[model samples]
Target chain A: MLRPWMRCSKNWRAMWNNFKSKFLGTNFKRFMGFVKKEFYHIFRDKRSMFILFGMPIAQILLFGFAITNEIKNVNIGILDKSKDSETIHITNRISSSPYFKIKNIVSSEQQIEAIFKKGQVKAVLVFEKDFGKNLKSTNLANVQIISDATDPNTANTVTNYIQSILQDYQREINLGIPGREPIEVRSRMFYNPELKGVFNFLPGVMTVILMLVSAMMTSISIAREKEQGTMEVLLVSPLKPLQVIIGKVFPYIFLSIINAIVILLLGFVVFGMPVQGSYFLLALETVLFILCALSLGILISIISKTQQTAMMISLMGLMLPIILLSGFIFPVSSMPWPLQAISNIIPAKWYNLILKGVMIKGVGLRFLWKETLILLGMTVFFIVLSIKKYKIRLE
Target chain B: MQALRDITFEVKPGELFGLIGPDGAGKTTLFRILTTLLFADEGTASVAGMDVVGDYRDIRKAVGYMPGRFSLYQDLSVEENLDFFATIFGTTVEENYDLIKDIYIQIEPFKKRRVVALSGGMKQKLALSCALIHKPKVLFLDEPTTGVDPVSRREFWDMLKRLNSTGITVLVSTPYMDEAELCNRIALIQEGELLVVDSPENIVANHTDSLYKVAAKNTYMLIKDLKDFKGNKSVYAFGEFIHYTHSNSDFSEERLGEYLEAKGHEDIKIVKARAGIEDVFMALSEKKGTEV
Candidate 1:
């Protein structure tokens, strides 16, 4: 027989006691101490600080400005055997485009191989004889384009640019002619109208910088403690292993956030890379990716016995895959089937997809839920595996 | 690989115990287990009356460990490192200042300097202070004086004696035989096996053979010559002198001196000497090797 108010007060008291015990059980004060020590380690070392903050900005700027996939100012050798008005007009049109510069003109086919071998010209274009006559009489003409196939990507892109320039010239010539209706395929580039390489590379740089700073830095820091023998001392203390790991990871999380902001600002200010979506959503997704990378770092630290090993594994095991297989430099659809399947497991792949979706496509969570879910799953998997591996090493 | 096997020893409360062994004698492995950093596959260990496996959390709060290497944060200042460790242990430097006052005061002048800039002796003192800041019940130090200078080594032992006087149990491991005399009890281990465990005096008293120190002009050749002596049971070089124990209990130093003279050795000096812990350690290791 208790009053209702009294019953509610008793329940509240019990709840408060449970909450207090749980808070005391984890020893938050000790965890804060570990986190503070980690900050001291980060701030005291000049070299590590440079690697943490400077490297990210440098990498982002380098990728945005210097490194590119687009072909421009390529040197080509033209062997115009026809010497007709149409052939001359087409040659002039090709040279006018900024994508190519006619470096050499050969008199014979034999000179084509010699010029290509000299490395002065990457492509050779030979016009068939009577090119203008054939176009007027049979409404067709033959032209050959031979490019260095050693670098297949560059070769393909160069050939495509030349074909598009020739097609445009054909439309201009046939515009006033009557009784010949040529079918023209109108193609337009969306989102990036000029096909600026920086636009495509911005999201990739963001993913790589975040992944490297978060995963690689955290792993190296933890492995350093083990190498110096301080990890043993930490284990002997009353701090739980989970607390130690969280404390080590917390500082990197803050650093990685700052790095993300720096990269976004540089991309916007220097390259004019647009952030079409909500900044808040982009930030939330970036944080999710950073957590995934941090957990991956923890897993690497647990398996490594020394800082050098941890660094090597983080670079070779994680960075290379993120660069090659995460669709950062190459399109995933064009990759080999096996590589495509393997890319699915790389967390950066999902993060890159989400970045493009949110930042470039201006899509909300509804469009990016799948990628977000994948990143969340990877974070959970890495954290769980790290904990299990840590326990096994302790035993 | 099985790093340890059939290892068994005990340390009483308020007693200073020593694990005397060389580099690969599994001393570090044993210390790791006792500190709850590692698990033994086939046996059990406990620290501060708590099981190392089941009650590791309780044991962790009651023990402090300093590994063989200098393990403090090299980038952080000495004071920062000390403060971090103390704070993590739910205590402060002021709370445990009395426990580490002697060692801490030595390095207080350079407290603002980074640990990497400190001399070996100062680093040792800083590590000791950090380990003691928590006021742990049992302190496990694995070869803390291995790379330290001799002067620092002696000072470290004095510090340990003072800490032990406060009723805190200390377990320390070292490879130096001379350090064995400082411990109340020592376990001589080799190749992951404990050959003998006893007080230094008792271990020396248990030696049955009459030991002699023999030195000549050519010490190396003298050792080669002494190995062939018919009365020799064990012969080893000890600094400037070769410590020789005879199979025959009645063997005399004069007889050994005469034998060396017969071997074309000049300026020979032979004297009866007392057995030391080093001698006992060598004899026990040899006996254990034969038994194996």
Candidate 2:
């Protein structure tokens, strides 16, 4: 319906409009410029870079030292009512083993509770008074092991050690009275057969490092703009808030990737921990986790007015949950129902699961689908909340 | 009423305009609205005749805004900072070389140095250079000379005047009344309200009262005694003297000296002095008091 020249002019106008919008519009190139600026801030500060890399290694070593299933030299108080040779032999067997340290030989039942109250002893091995008559007639004797349940893992390990010692002692005594068939129970540890502490701590380190690099660092960067008054300048620019946030987060994403590589390398070289699954899958999951953390950081930045508030929010809101509820060091199944319910809300819990699933179990997408879906949903929810808050502030 | 009450003023091409006020006088609110950082609750504003909200991208490309505080990328080197802002506007320093060359060449030696390490005067110069790097149609500097030394302040104004000669609109805001004289026109604002808008000389020429400077051996005592005098209309302490306007002009300098002598004063001097923008500001603000 239009003349050829007119159509050409219209098309030319269209092309100019398109060029202007694309060149200046919230595009990858423009956003990349903003992101490059953010990287400049991060790379310029050597302290933050050090924290991003060094914290993971330091935390991994700390958690590794703090958590161990192996029981060694557990302090104990023995309450022996009978001073018989058989009872003394049993006490010697218990004390001679590396697992139990005989801190006290209390002669009274009342002292048993005091020893535990003072916190000097973890368990009390009690031998009831019998004069050896019961063992001679019944061919069986009982030794009771009472343990402090404050730390259930320690208590559980100590019980297992004492039981194994008792079984060995019983076998030696039973051999003297032959013609008896003994029933033996065998146990095999699963997942972490050697029960290396580093294995347990590596996943936790990954969760913490991802959170610090992706959430805390990003929040601080955004808040720094608010502090320096540059945020106002950027806001006044033609760039949309989404474009600005994307720019701010892009560099952090790259930094987190580098951080992940460093942590994986440290876990492999220093700790000698292996990633049983595909490295590609681990890297992919790490990137997804970083996205979730960055969304959370943006959400925090939207809520906080200053850098101090952002830092505090990140520390209190993210650190404890990542350590306690992520099933990083503790088994989630062993936790109470209320704690288990609370852990489900923390993103780090899902991330820890994904890390363990991939790095330890070598599972496929089928095993990590639910966790991945939850992380994606959290990312979306955080982003939506931040946008809503930012809009409210703008209004 | 609009949040800014439909502020409508135009800076002639290559002219310098000042919006003078204290904090919370709606000076910044207006600057923000004009810069496209905020939208008014009602009415509209534009820069370079492009609607602030609709044509913000073009407006942004056209204007260089220096906020009330010195806000540049302090982490970046002075040179990198200039280059970054220049690139954002899709131009190079070489393209608009002459625009900011005068200001940039001063700090050019420290170009590779971080902006944070620069002195306040140097920082101000760098900020102005970045604003001018894009060769903007209009430059908005909000309180650009607030905390600088008197020498730096004078130098900054000289730079602004030079920039104005290049046919670029320069709009600045400051609470300093002396700086108001440097502008072609200024709007006096108080408590989110614009009281008066006119040239600095015109505002001073329009001062309603005959002002006099009275001093004695004890200046503070003289000021206190003058306030209590029945004939004294208004008395404010100026440098080295007390500026007093009388209720009536029937009294002469001899009478003022006699009055001060009666009030236990000596070495009295009373002489007529030229009124400044601050005097006019005090008079106009007092006349419009408690209304904002």
Candidate 3:
């Protein structure tokens, strides 16, 4: 039995080598030439060049800086009626912190409201008269933090930061007392709850860039051929429809992969956001999502007649849904049931989950098999639909 | 939107055929149907002995098509476009360089330049070279000289004539009637219908009516007075003179000159003129309009 199996293996190996040589002879040259032409086309166009490489880096950097929780140089007005060392010390501490910048000081309580009304400050700190004396005698004092509510989210963060600074001052002043624990309340935010890390936005920006370059660019380029009449020449040539499509998308696939690598590097270096899981698995999943987007691009190009229509449909039709309903910004669980059901159909939604899971959650394939399967399923569905929609001849 | 109806013609293997018509005459539609880029809703056609519908893949491999528009990749350099077309047909440019060398040599100096930087005539030449790189049995050129200057258009036609002489059957369409005289055979088309198909000599020779070229100092009044005349069947402005044909076969130029004199026209000239393809096309289309 062992001898027969060895003989069969040798025969199969010879057949495989023969098949490889035949296909690699003529078809390989044709395919490589086609790919080279596509590369020249993309490299020579300045707009396409900007979209391909420049867009990913610009988008990643902009989003990385936008979402970090660091609130620096927030202007504020202080009303200090108490002329004492303790009041001055607390004011010095608030100004020293990076979060607040004191723009003005008011001697009267009425002037505090005037500063806010004048828009001279985003927030105001008011201290009561004789604060130092009251704290020394009663062991308690009050400070009021009034913030502008025009932007409620920033106001909340500003007020929360001021309260914590005041509490810190209270703890520092009470340290000399003996036989007291001071009732310390230490709060720890788990898994980057401080929102200081750029990890939360990394996946969202990567999805948007990949979708824009991979899907929108590919669709518009193919439609450009149609508009310019080059597609008619291609159709009349000996190239098969599948070969034509592969030739057109080969350069985009390479560029999209490079774009993904650039985004990951920026996330790691500029943002210090690391992938906690295996890099190999992340790359494989990324390739899967790119395939899905490319297939969608092919479908769009088939239906569109010109580059303008392709660009319009890709941006207004595909990009909007990926940004809005992919849970990249808003959580899917919080969405209504109908929208949640629709979101399940979007590949970016599943890919976003997989990106977060592998990069932030440190989960392996076993934990993310469902999302991976959904993405894989979407890839196949889009590819098959694109093939069915591909037209061999102009109508 | 029936773009064509009952449009039929055939080209011999070695003869150069021209589809002569004006714009909107459905020449491009027929070219598309033959090149396997479109499907006919009612009729069946074959290209080089292969059915366009059933054996479309073979038809595509057999014929080379240059659309009415300049359709090559404008961003790709001239050499790159040629090499790309050659490779896709599984043949290297060097292998078929003999076929395209005559045409490609003119644009060789600018082979490194992108197609967008090329002039209208050079772009047309490059397009033709790319179409011929594979050395197809038949070539379809649709309005190849629509936007070129006079010198370039003449050079472009000279190349086509040379290609035809080399035993490559050429099916070219043009809105310019003068180019019709250069082909071995021609088809007069208008309004999605074929008016007639014959050799250039036969088309003009077949014009039955006796045509007279009428000239006067006041060209506008000459046409007006002729249209007002009763015996003339058709009056058209052909170049600097008005070509008029009468209803009766024996109507003389002297009689027409006398009629113009009565209409207060001075220094009138009328002579029996030999008909050309343009004269035949106009008459045939006007006849077709009346029949319809």
Best by DockQ: 3
Worst 10 residues of 3 chain A by lDDT: A190-199
State which candidate, 2 or 3, has the greater TM-score. 3
Model 1 chain B: lowest-lDDT 10 consecutive positions:
B247-256
Model 1, runs deviating above 4 Å? A1-26, A44-47, A69-181, A392-395, B1-8, B206-208, B217-232, B247-268, B287-292
- Cα lDDT tens digits, model 2, A170-232, are 777778566653786777766777777777778888888889888998898888888788777
What is the C-alpha local distance difference test score of candidate 3? Answer: 0.87
TM-score of model number 1: 0.85
Of the two candidates 1 and 3, the one with more favorable DockQ, higher being better, is 3
Candidates in order, TM-scores: namely 0.85, 0.84, 0.92
Q: Tell me the deviation in Å of residue B186 in model 2.
A: 1.5
Tens-digit per-residue lDDT, A1-395, candidate 3: 56987887879878776876786766677788888888988898899999888888888888878755568899998888786898899889889998889999877777777877888888888888898999988877777888888878788889999989988888887887874337889998755565654777889889888888888988998898889888899899878888878888888889999999999999899988888899999999999999889988988998999999999999988889989999988889999999999888888888899999999878899999999998888888888988998888986
lDDT against the true structure, per candidate, is: 0.89, 0.82, 0.87
i-RMSD per candidate, Å? 2.3, 3.3, 1.0
Compared with the true structure, what per-residue lDDT tens digits does model 1 show for residues B1-292? 7777788888899999999988899999999888877878878887888999999888888988898888889988999999999988999899999999999999999999988899999999999999999998999999999989999999999999999999999999999999999999999888888888888888889887778888899998999999999967899999999998888777777777888888899999888899998898888888887887
